[model samples]
Target: MAYKELIGSFDEVRNYIREFFIYGIKKRSDFSDKSGRTYDNRRRQIESWLDGYMSFQQSASGKAQIISVDSREVVHNPLYKAFKTKNFSDYDILLHFCILDMLAGGKELAFRNIAGELQEYGFSGEENVINERTIRLKLQEYEKLGILKVRTEGKKKQYYSLSADAVDLVSWQDAIEFFSETEPMGVVGSFLLDRKELAGCQSNFWYKHHYMLHAIDSEIVETILEGIAEKKYLELVTSGKKHSEEKIKLYPIKLYVSTQNGREYVLGHVSGASGLDFIRVDRIKKVKTGIRCGEYQKFENEYQASKSYLWGVSSGNAKDITHIEMTVRAAEGEEFIVRRLEREKRNGHVYKITDQQYKYVVDTYDAMELMPWIRTFMGRIEKLESSNPQLKKKFDQDMEQLYSMYFGEAQNDIS
Candidate 1:
């Protein structure tokens, strides 16, 4: 017998995967976004799906529940089943069968044709609102997905069933393995490998920071991307540090994802702004299409030029550029250190001073954004000079604080 677990919304499943599995080891209150009743329902649903894989541990403060899957014990990722068991409504199931049955006779039908057929076939029950609009929307979606092909002749448009694009296991084997391990939403790719007789690939990634919600928000990402593709303006309702419940119009530029932390951001600018701006997708409360981005090329060019000055996402006005230079003392066997600096330095230059020394330099819009990374090479950092004196002070202050925190005022006495 198949276990049918019900979910209230996609958000419920999202909360489960985010709270218990991806970033597990979380307390009950960690899910403050949802009501207590809603949270409990999701927890129960997750337990039903994962079954034995879910477990709880008692901490000093509270109990923390998590999904415990040992690769050596479990044959496959347990979460794969979670994706398969999406809660579909009775209407959804009926619509699926109806769409196929109507299209089965090698017939080409318009939205109206399909909807009329469904009406005659009697899909609507006592209280159902399965109207022509609903049926038409479904058929149009099917066409887009390549499940149905559309033909346009003279002034009329018609659609018929077309074979969907199928994947070949032989060619996608390695690509699947690497994707499953490294990328977010790789579970879908991994799920494809399971469809083949080969089962899952041997490769597995032990993700320390799995921002799995990015996959769920692929809809938002895709919508924004489509808007960009059409060169359209975006209306964003964003709540973050600078803005609170603020609604604004933005020109679509590009999306940025942090490799260090798997957070996604959209980079764009509001009207009459001298500098580029960024908004976190997670922080975005709502998004809508505004107008056609007729001047997108201008913003696109600005975005390209802005890239050179960005050490991170933080960028200043068009003219603001801060130059920073650092001398590093690399030990005898750590030549890889120099190589590391060069490879990771975006829009930066690394020059070899001698056998044991190197100079790393970069010009960025905001030097403040680059300081955290600069602090990483604390011991080896020599003559940390910046075009911005304030940034230099902050860096020196941070270094001093670190020294005092660890070594204490004894180091101050030595200085």
Candidate 2:
């Protein structure tokens, strides 16, 4: 069965237990023999699956350590009994221990680097392997639990380190005894304890940012990301009015988030195009990597300046600079409007107006694209005016219709 199917069955079995207990209480009788046997079997199956899962995790973690041998053992010892008796499932404990071990390795690793190391360690098996995606998720959970500290290294890189005072929790002897008792049962339990003692040394080393695009299948997107990291140029077919059958080469500088959707797009320059261009990955048909991009430094200042005028990811053709404005009211419980507006301004946009009643603004692009944000504050705001006369008229008409439908003296009276 698929992993998801197994997970569904496990949840169903757990639900059955809750239902069975409820029915037993209602009937004022003990569970039937058959029902009791079924519950026991299902519980056993879940435990077995959990054991297998943990063993795989431990094995993968060990392999990762072996590959990154630069890690030194931590000096502070953690209490093994404290961790073992905490009611954490065997899988949870194994995952926790693996993360601790990684953090103890003396170097801060990025999420992708940790995932890649896990993959390399041969923890993934044919039927019940732990995938890198799952490992990344588990790492996040560990961070939330305060076992690790996650901090951003750059825009895309997140580094993980051991939490303060993590080493003082348990002693080396306690860890050894706990491992000895649990090791014979499963791979996860055995491997963790086999090391004799927990590593306690702390060091200051950080991993490089390696962006791994997960959902995109476009080769062009992959080529572009890889090219940017390697400082290389790429040749691709143009999609806009300057469409050409011939492939054009350009140096990739940075990635921008698409305004329409949260999808990523490449912001680069065309070799002979008049100005900087934005190309959608899905629109490009072909891509070829070229030599290192030595000219990227020259465009850094220009890119920084252009960011303020950008509407979403598209800088909107280098020549067309359309100024946009909109009015939005802050909803009753939505005091976050001011903070959000401040954040936008901090990112380099103009904050035209901020007052008690509503917010008005002049931004670099069309306000229609920001309509969703405006709608979120519907009851709070009223349409005022737009820099472009046509856009202002449309917004005024839309707001009037919305007001007629939902606005009333009675609606304001309740609050």
Best by TM-score: 1
lDDT tens digits by residue: candidate 1, 173-240: 77776565445445656567776544744644354544444655554566678777888888877654
TM-score of each: 0.73, 0.41
Which tens-of-lDDT digit does each residue in 15-107 have in candidate 2? 332233211221112335466555455444434433322111123223110011111241211111212322344455566666677668677
List runs of model 1 lying over 4 Å from the truth: 1-87, 94-136, 153-159, 164-166, 180-213, 240-244, 272-274, 318-320, 331-333, 394-415
Error of 1 at 387 (Å): 2.2
What is candidate 2's CA lDDT for residue 229?
85
Candidate whose lDDT is highest: 1
Candidate 2 weakest lDDT stretch, 10 residues: 63-72
Model 1 — which ten-residue stretch has the worst lDDT?
A: 204-213
lDDT of each: 0.71, 0.51
